[model samples]
Structure formats: C-alpha cells, structure tokens
Target: MARTTTPLTNTQVKQSKPTDKRQKLSDGGGLQLWISPNGSKSWMLDYIHPITKKRLSMSFGIYPAVSLADARKKRAEAKELIANGIDPKEHREDQSRLQELTNSHTLQTVASDWFEIKKSKVAETTSKSLWRNFDKHLFPKLGHRPIDKFNPKRSSALKLSFDIGI
Candidate 1:
C-alpha cells in the first residue's frame, strides 16, 4: 500500500483509533508528535545526551493535557538541557522543581542550577573551572548534600555568583 502523511492535529488526534498504530507525520527532523487510533497524542523528543552518548526519548504528557505550545516549549527546554550536560526531565524534576523555582530557596541549589543554565553560553575552560572549584571547596565538604541541610547563607549566593563569573 502507498504511504502518506497525516498531520496529527487536535481534531485528527481526537479521531485517532487505538489500532491506528505508528504513523509517519514528518521525516526531516520535525517528526515527533504522532497519534494512535485511540486518539492519544504524545510528543516525542529526539535528542542525544553528550555524557551518556545515548539518544533520549521524552513524552510531553497527553495532547489535551499538554497544549501544543507547552509541548514545543518543553522540547526547547529539553534541547537546552541536553546542551548543558544535564538531562532536562531528570534534572528539573530532581533539582529545579516548580515549587523550588521561586525566590526563598537555597542559594546552593539555585547556584547549581545557575551553573547548568549557563553551561551552554560560557567557554569550556570557564565551565570546568567553576565546577572544579565548587567540587573541591564545597562538594566534598557540603556538596551532593541537600539544600536545606546546609542552611547556606543567603548572602553567600551573591558572593558565589561573582566568584564563579556566573
């Protein structure tokens, strides 16, 4: 049988059958979202992790639950995470959770995330130096430890950023 592409629109997604099976939506890099016959729509992330050297596949929740705009945003965030040597899904969930995203959080946690955020923009030497410093001075003594456990001084955050060129 000749093959053709079917755009996975909300309308089309609503009409999908559980038996519809895997259907090709796009092939030139933008081929992630696909709908099953049962009308279940999911976003598939195609990226490779630098450290693991393995391809990453991620789901952006159900279609209706996660709007198209939100899905695209997640895809972008995932790509940014990959660029920074951090797994977006795991790291965000593990460290930068929404509840902890706002102010009034640990300076150390925020600082670590800041490092991850800036990993892509800085030079390799800078990035390595920052981590090396942190690992040697803080990590072995108080690193890999939870945020609240340390009660990091609030003023310390500002000092840390300036020291690391963050």
Candidate 2:
C-alpha cells in the first residue's frame, strides 16, 4: 500500500525549525518546504519529467515571500505544464529569451541600425535631414514600441498622424 502524506498547514510551516541537516516538510502532491541548516527556507516541487521519466526538483521561491498557498498554486501550474509534455524550467527560459529579443527589437533600435547604413550611402546633409525628421516625428510617438506589434492598421494610423500634424 502507498503511504499517504498529510497536507501541511500554515501553522506547521511557520513553526518549523531548522536542524543540523537540511530538512524537507511535505505538503503532499510533491510540494515541499526545504529548510537549510543556515535557517533559510524555500519552496520546492518534485515532479517526473514528461519525456525522461526522471524525477526533477524545481524551486518555487523563498518562504514567507512565497506563502504555502502561493507554492501550492505554482505546484499546480507546474503539474499542468508537465501534463502537456513541456518542462516548466525550459518554458520559463524560453519566455525570458523571447522577452529579451522583443525588448532589443524596439522601433528606435531598428531605426538606428538602418540609419547607420543609410548614413554611409547618402550625402551628409540628406542623411542628417532624414534622421532629424525621424527623431522629431516618429520617435516621439512610436520609438519604444516593439516591431512585432506593428500591423497595417497601426501603420496607416501613424501615417495619418503625420498627415494631420499630430
């Protein structure tokens, strides 16, 4: 027969004390509170990787900062990701990378890159005048926007803004 784990309460969690070695207090469903000998407490979730069938541990966050309730919610979210055959850690890293790419590809950054090549090909005065127009008109309204968010409707709206002196 499989042994059952009793779910932990907030009081039990709060009253836990660190020992000479690391300790894990289970809250059932693979959620555990890890207490280090140094008195640090953090939440951890144990799960089997969908593809590998190997057990893995993922850190939720620190105690107090991530309450028992919050840790349980994260555990549910991680289990959902695992059920869909996606590793939560990899998903998180991919999201971080995508956000970094999106942030780096803002309108002003792309425009500056194009302007560098244009400067080398055009006469100095023409290049300066072109950049001046971009700086004065487009940058103020759309410079910080991500390139991926642009659409035909928004593009035309921007053109209309220039036409109407907005």
Candidate 3:
C-alpha cells in the first residue's frame, strides 16, 4: 500500500526551522516547501513530464511571496495542463518565446530589416540618406513602439514621404 502524507498548515510552514541540511515539507499532491540550510524557503511542484515520463520538479516561487494558497492554485494549473496532454514547462517556454518575439519585433527592428535588404541593393549615399531620414523623422516617435501598435497616419513623413515616395 502507498503511504499517505499529511498536508502542511500555515502555522507549520511559518514555524519550520532551518536544520544543518535542506529539508522538504510536503503539502501533498506533489507540492512541497523546500527549506534550505540557510532558512530560505521556496515552493516546488513535482510531476511526471507528460512526454518524457520522467519525474520533473518546477519551482513555483519563493515562500511568503508565493503563499500557500497561491502555490496550490499554480499546482492545480500545472496538473490541468498535464491532464490535457501538455507539458507545463514546454507551455511556459512557448509563452516566453512569444513574448520575446513580440518585444523584438518593434518598429525600429522592422525598419532596420528593411534597411538591410535595401542596403545591398542601393548605393551607399542613398542608404545613408534613407537612414538619416528615418532617424530625423519617424524613429523619434515610433522607434521603440511595437509594429502592431504603430499608426502610419500619425506620422506625416511616414504616410506621405515614405509611403507615396513624395
């Protein structure tokens, strides 16, 4: 028969003392609070990776900051993802990748890409003039803004001079 473990309480967690070695206090369902020898506490969830079938552990957050209730909620979400045939770690990685891509695809970045393609095809003088125009007119307002939020009509230089070649 499998042994059953008792869940932890707020008082127990609060009163937990640091020992010479690191200790893990189980809150059940693969959720546990890890106490380091230095008394630093953090939350962790242990689960079998859906694809690899290997035991994996994910850190929820530092204790007190994460709180017991919040850790349980995160555990439930990870469990749900596992049940849905999704790997929680992979899902998190995918979301981070999307966020990074969104952050990188700014107006300045798009403009730089256009400059690169045009650079090889145009004369050096024209290239420098084109970049100078972008720096003088459009970049000041829209350089840092993401492409999705950029409005062409807001900049007369972009709409008339660049778009229509005026």
Candidate 3 clashes between residue pairs 3 or more apart in a chain or in different chains: none
> What TM-score would every model get versus the actual structure?
0.45, 0.76, 0.76
Q: Name the lDDT of candidate 1.
A: 0.64
Task: Give Cα-based local distance difference scores for all models.
Answer: 0.64, 0.88, 0.88
Query: Looking at model 1, how many pairs of residues clash?
Result: 6
| Worst 10-residue lDDT window, candidate 3 | 157-166
Model 3 TM-score is 0.76
The residue-by-residue lDDT of candidate 3 on 1-166, one tens digit each, is 7558998999999999999999999998999999999989999999999988999999999989999999999999999999998988888889999988898998889889988988888789988998898898878987887787756788565677567552
Off by over 4 Å in 3: 1-6, 119-129, 136-141, 151-166
Tens digits of per-residue lDDT, candidate 1, 98-148, equal 555443455456567878988789899988997787767765655544455
Ordered by TM-score, highest first, the candidates read 2, 3, 1
